[model samples]
Target: MLRGVTHHITATREDGTVFEVSYGYGARQRRLLACLHCDWEEQITYGGTRHKGLDHLAQAHGAVGNPTMTADARARRQVLWTMAICFLISAVILWWATSRT
Candidate 1:
């Protein structure tokens, strides 16, 4: 029944991380490929190109603070980095204060 299906995707992880899973099926030899996402994960078989049902790790954990970042993702990483630095500083201060005798 998937003869008309083209490229497809079947997420392998679920964490509300990705926006969508790029999937499509083909009518040829019944092959499929998918760009996995956090909200969906499934097996697919149809006529298509290379494997795709895999995590888009680059978008999820790609480089941060690069001059190329120009969107919300960059903003999100900045906030997270700032928070991490603040937390580290706080931990060090706490250690020093408690160690003082």
Candidate 2:
């Protein structure tokens, strides 16, 4: 799952059997998909860096592992803020131009 982009990360035992973490802040749930003994697929939205949410997909129900195992949430908070700013700016400009005519 090292294809897209990396997110917030946490290291665990070297056994490679740790709980993987991925934030999936979908339009619905801010899910945290935690995979066990494996990786996950992720994507960056908005600011092209900050992530939307998290998804946790545990290996097995009550599997033995650590929460500090997940790789890392690469995106940052700035991304979201940046996106919000741009959107607000665009909205203001659109409203202003429309009201003029």
Candidate 3:
């Protein structure tokens, strides 16, 4: 069975403390969020997990900063960019071919 892709959101304090929250869908397609610094987790049936994670970091850990996505999320975004470029190229080629014919 293929595993679901997991992405992490990290926050840091000025004191150099770091906190991370991982959010992703499970094998059964249930959305899950878990904090790396503590025993805090939630199976989200609705709403956004990112806000929840940010809230946790700010409220529980007092770590406030612009959260950053981990490599997995960046890779996913890269895939989207690649796909959009490929689609645009194909559209242009199709338009050129039809114009010639």
Candidate 4:
């Protein structure tokens, strides 16, 4: 189920250190972010992947500020939000129907 290309990120620290990060629909089609440096990795189960990745970069690697969300991340977020809204509407409709009957 990975339907698109995986994003690869490179962050360089002020001390000239570099880190490699890869995130996307990874193994088992789960969204994940993994750092190639120092064993920092996370599976994005909730919230924003960009935020988590940026946090890791800033805190661990001394990266400056948060980086913009990649195109893939943005698209994924839109899809997730849309699905969530649709699910909420469905649940509401189900509740209303049940109450009416």
Model 2, 35-95: lDDT tens digits are 3345544444344222222122322222233334332322323454687899999999999
RMSD from true fold, candidate 3: 11.9
Q: Quick one: best lDDT, which candidate? A: 3
- Which segments of candidate 2 are over 4 A away from where they belong? 1-75
Record all residue pairs in model 4 with backbone atoms less than 3 Å apart, i.e. clashing.
Answer: none
Q: For every model in order, what is the number of clashing pairs?
A: 20, 27, 0, 0
For each candidate, the alpha-carbon lDDT, in order, equals 0.43, 0.40, 0.73, 0.68
Q: TM-score for each prediction?
A: 0.35, 0.30, 0.56, 0.51
lDDT of 4 at 95: 98
Instruction: State the lDDT of candidate 1 residue by residue for 1-101, as single tens digits.
Output: 33344433222224423233344443554443433333433345443222233334344523122223336444554676898899999999999999997
Give the candidate number with the greatest TM-score: 3
> How far is each candidate from the true structure, as Cα RMSD in Å?
12.1, 15.3, 11.9, 15.1
* Global lDDT of model 2: 0.40
Higher-ranked by lDDT: 1 or 3: 3
| Candidate numbers, best lDDT first, in rank order | 3, 4, 1, 2
Better of 1 and 2 by TM-score: 1
Report the C-alpha lDDT of model 4 over 3-92, residue by residue, as the tens digit.
333775655567744455677776778788887676886888987766677778878888643366355445555676898899999999
C-alpha root-mean-square deviation, candidate 4: 15.1
